[model samples]
Target: MPRALSTPPVIAPGSLGGSPQPVLPVTGGLLLRPWEEADVPAFLSAYQDDEIRRWHTRRPSTEGQVQEWFEAYRQDWKHEKGGHWAITCDDDAEVLGRIALRGLDFDDGMAGVAYWVLPAARGASVAARGLRSLTTWALAEIGFHRLELDHSTRNHASCRVATKSGYLLEGTKRSAAVHDDGRHDMHLHACIRGH
Candidate 1:
């Protein structure tokens, strides 16, 4: 029989999602958990906004494309890889955003972080709490040595998120890739294990 999870004050090394996936209870102004089918409508609304599109890779995605993306999101958890979580309010469990570590590399001990919050949740502490919790788990439980995040140079809020999460400003990649508007400047940031 499988062993039951033990409570640890801090993240436990290699304790995230192996023998049995741990459901971390992270809270700030809100709480975070794995995504649910009920969150689809709210998730769609957040992704459809103009500003959110501007910061993401898909700016004007078709409904079909969005559905496909959503499907992939649903399937991510089942894979032997990383998964996304929905950020919900603490007072009322209304999903306000999402945070995830995609492209997980257990062997290499690394992962790339990504996140987004609904406009209503902006200025709230949800993002910070979610980012910190996820990072801590990835480094401690998942045994990752490095965690990296990227943002467009134009996205000041995203940049702030990275800096606030203790990621170092590595440098800029000039015209590294084209965006929906056919222009681009990317800012790369990273946080290493043990400070």
Candidate 2:
């Protein structure tokens, strides 16, 4: 029989800072920081990509919708629900992509990570680097026992990123979620702390 789980302490906003957001530095001068209003254009552009639209459900067609999306990120962080970071180079502020920890559950001591890189930023390991950085922070700094990531079984690029970021494939959920094309089987991957 499984033992009763210990209650994890509630994570309060500003415990880490005025905002519970983290700015992570990645390879090649790329830095992951909180998404800003200035990044809306780049965010919209990245989402216009076929791959992003294919895999993710939320697609904002207008600039206002994009702003709403950014606002949602702020709300999430302010409430200690989750964090979203824009992937950008240090020299320029243009967003290259995004990475986020969503669906935070303190009771379970777990969260889900997701990421996407602009087409121009692909093939340079930007997603992998960002994922690794976030995973490390989530486990060490945030005290999460497990970090989970999932992608369509057909998304080979995501598979590579998950493996390269040290997340082991756990199993597949058949028809777990619906995508643009239809229901997709998702491969669940996870990295547990102290493993």
Candidate 3:
């Protein structure tokens, strides 16, 4: 018989009190800050990319929907449900991408990460840098024991980002998620504390 898994310590309330989200500095003068209403146009534009649409299950199609999404992000933070940030370059008003720690389970000391870089920002290692910065903060500042990042198995680019950011490829979740085209096998990657 296999041993039962041990329950991890729960994260304390207000541990993630950086609501309105603090600006995290990344390589190349990039910053990860809270999403703002003014960014809605850029957010909508980024989702128009076929690659973004292919990998992300949800894409807001209208300005109102995008605003709603931003509101939800605020609510998530206010309720301590999760954290989301817009990746941008210093001295620029446009968003380069987005990275988030979602599916938060304080009792398990775990959370799931997700990201998307704009087409213009692809091949610049922007995603990897943002992922590394976020993971570091989540583990060190927020005290999460484990962070998981998963992507469609077919997304080789994302696989590279995950590995480059120090996430180890654990395994695959067979047909774990449904895409617009069909179901996708997800490649599961994780970074555990003290690893």
RMSD of each: 6.5, 3.6, 4.0
lDDT by residue (39-119, candidate 2, tens digit) is: 888888877899998888878888899999888888888776789999888898978889999988776678999999998
Candidate 3 residue pairs in backbone clash:
none
Ten residues in a row with the worst lDDT in model 3? Answer: 2-11
Residue pairs whose backbone atoms clash in candidate 2: none
89-176, model 1: which lDDT tens digit per residue? 7677698878988877655577799899888878876677788888887786666889998888988988888888888999998987
- Sorted by TM-score (best first), the order is 3, 2, 1
Ranking by lDDT: 3, 2, 1
Q: What is the TM-score of each candidate against the true structure?
A: 0.81, 0.91, 0.93
Candidate 1 matches the true fold with a TM-score of: 0.81
Better of 1 and 2 by lDDT: 2
lDDT of 3 by residue, 9-55 (tens): 56976667554578899988899999998999999998899999999
Give me the overall lDDT of model 2: 0.87
